[model samples]
Target: MNHKVCVQLVVAAWITGVPAQIGVTYQIFCQNFCGSNKLNHIFCDSSTLLEIACGDTYQKEISLLVNTFFFVVIPFLLILISYFRIIATILKLPSTSGKSKAFFTCSSHLMVVCLFYGSVTIVYVRSKSSHSAKSNKVFALLYTIVSPVLNPMIYIA
Candidate 1:
């Protein structure tokens, strides 16, 4: 059952990532080649993908929609529904230890999810601006640097 849920999440990620990647690639190419050279080069620079992506209107919109719906909305709903079912099942368990264990596990997972989605949403779903470069860099750093360090601690605890 847990394996199935993991597989579903993987599938959902792939479903979202592939199309969005393609769209963003096309849009970035257009912007870099035909539009205004918002990015430094024609082919994508992996190190600066996020910066390049946020620079163009088409890439930004598509990325926002895709990340908001796929990474944020769908995962949130799935986690919510799964937790509801888990709580129901846990409530019916005969032992207090079982209930405590379940709640602890769920709570930890929820914390990680909240941290991840919160950072992702802030970075992708928020307003764009010329003066927001610093804030955007901060958010990007949070998502890339901080999240990785925190996620493991969160999940393990």
Candidate 2:
């Protein structure tokens, strides 16, 4: 029970923190990007924000690298390490009567973790190799907007 509560709190912190970071970054970027021109998408797009923030050549490259690292790479590594530790602990457990039940619970959690992390990694990990503005926008939409919506669906399932 204590472990569950702690885990829930940690997850809550992460969920809250990521978006807050994004929001702060967005505001900082938007101050530069949000004038005169109307954004095509309803939600404030990160790429659009970046395009606006990157008015100068130096600023553009720096903003791109920073956004990619923070929004994509860091989260991917964190999720990977988390899941690895989870699975390792599960695997090392001794067999018992409740083992099946424990496995079932872990399976559901593993599924959600994989789905969320996989989508995020698929999108953001690609950014490290290829530097396409369009791809970044598409992945940003996936990781930021679409994945959050799907996360709840995974939990519900």
Candidate 3:
């Protein structure tokens, strides 16, 4: 298939999975959180919600880790594999300019992926504590703001 067709198929698959992801996330996180309504983090993301949870969180943490492994870690691994293949292909090109050009085509994409996923893993995947809340916000900001802004700058450049 052509690149466009392949992209469309990926998009279709992603669209179908989004609801399932959202559903599982909502089931895991949407709960009667007992604490000060005032949250410590800038956003009311899972990390913040988890900080305020009242009961024993062993079960919830396990579920979140499993869900994260499936949704985040798996996809990140796939992306890394794809980049490895791309890098191999680029390395095989004989012309110096050809290799650089090929690498440049996807370099920005890889950077953006690393920026977002690396920050996300730090913010959500790690076991959180009150002390870590401050650091989580920094990573969350990178995930939400800095990573996305790079997309336009890098891709549109």
Candidate 4:
């Protein structure tokens, strides 16, 4: 695809996300939280907030799950497939140095992708019964600290 098309696709993706974010955020905040306002996690993430909401969160959970599938899981799958193709191409490189360079770059990028999507999946995609709020907080904490630190180091290297 051309650069223009890629940029347009990215913008279009952002356009799609804006409504999901706003709609979810609006619905969550509109509710009177049943109990303590403070969440265990640092980030006031929507999923955690929904947990404390007074009324039925069935719609919110479904919306979150759908959004997670479309935004996080699908994109992660695409990245993994693209990386597999890249590794295959890299293995066919004639020179050892070229192969090593390609491998290093691809591995770093994959690590970042896994870290990001893994963190998100843990927090939002998992059934509330499957994980404790405290564990979610820990993962979210690690995700916020780890991904950004690694991004500059890995991508720039």
Candidate 5:
């Protein structure tokens, strides 16, 4: 379980961070081409560094796509499968002996799963035409940072 959790954390971080890095780079390029050399916002600034890193959008796009596939889709599918299995197991159990206890136990797990995956799905599984960057960043932070902090606390409770 610890190993699995570690792997999941690593994978999740990669998934969240890669696109964020790409997005930052893109924002940087967009800034450099469109705005001044220096960025006004602390977190939003990457123009100076990105300009030094890559010359074209094609290379950045390729990197973004590859990272999205490996980090985003792959782990999401795995997590979805795992959660389905958990739900299936919970459903399969007879609701007779200690059913209430079982439900309580599984409910916490399910809540954590929902919180983590739901936030991620909301952020990533939307049309770019539909959601704004602010909304995406909000949900992204929830799933990536807040969910991890809450997971163990939920388990303990």
Candidate 6:
């Protein structure tokens, strides 16, 4: 079970990170040259590095697409499948105590999953929705700092 979970997480991180990294790298590089737009890191915009990555509308669209797929759809599908198998396994157990214990473990996992994904989704969505640099910084900071801090606490709880 531990191995499977580790594989799932590693795969999830790979899937989520790689494509977006390639796409963003290509977009930032190509667009700046291919369009001959001045690549100025001006103070008029970008309070955080995330804002710089998402400086343009096209970049923002790409980010939204990646986040929607990786953070929302893929995780939802994986979690659903895992939970289904867990339910089946627990049902096959002979004793009430075993099933209860399984469910308790699953519930904690579910809570942590919710906390991690929920904050990320909110950060991505909020970043996309708002035009303010300050709010974007706040969202970025929350995701970068608070989510990591909370994840372990959630697991411990």
Clashes of each: 0, 0, 0, 0, 0, 0
Candidate 1 — which residues are off by over 4 angstroms? 2-16, 33-63, 129-131, 154-157
Model 2 TM-score (2 dp): 0.52
Over the stretch 46-84, how does candidate 2's per-residue lDDT look in tens digits?
Answer: 445544553553454455556657755777688768777
lDDT of each: 0.65, 0.60, 0.79, 0.85, 0.61, 0.61
Name the candidate that leads on lDDT.
4
Indicate the TM-score of model 5. 0.53
Candidate 4: which pairs clash?
A: none
Better of 1 and 2 by lDDT: 1
TM-scores, all models, native as reference: 0.65, 0.52, 0.82, 0.91, 0.53, 0.57
Predict model 1's lDDT versus the native: 0.65
Q: Write the per-residue lDDT of candidate 4 for residues 61-152, one digit (tens) a residue.
A: 89889988988898889989998898989999999999999998888878887988899888878888899877897789767888888889
Residue-level lDDT tens digits of model 5 in 1-157? 6999999988988888877777756655563253344433223323223333434644544554565565567776787688778767767877656566767777776676777767765654454468765666677677777888977887786
Question: Candidate 6, clashing residue pairs?
Answer: none
lDDT per residue for candidate 3 within 1-157, as digits (tens), equals 8999999989987986787568656854666677587888878776567667777767767766776777779889999999999999899999999998778878988989998988887776776543376787788899899998888888676
**Shift in Å, residue 37, candidate 1:** 8.8
Model 6 lDDT, full chain set: 0.61
Highest TM-score scorer: 4
Candidate 5: give the clashing pairs: none
Off by over 4 Å in 6: 1-16, 26-56, 126-157
Worst 10-residue lDDT window for candidate 1 reads 39-48
Q: Evaluate residue 44 in candidate 6 and report its C-alpha lDDT on the 0 to 100 scale.
A: 24
Model 2 residue 120 CA deviation in Å: 5.0
lDDT of 1 by residue, 86-131 (tens): 8899899999998998898888777766666676667566654532
lDDT of 2 at 47: 44
Task: Please report how far candidate 5 places residue 93 from its true position, in Å.
Answer: 2.7
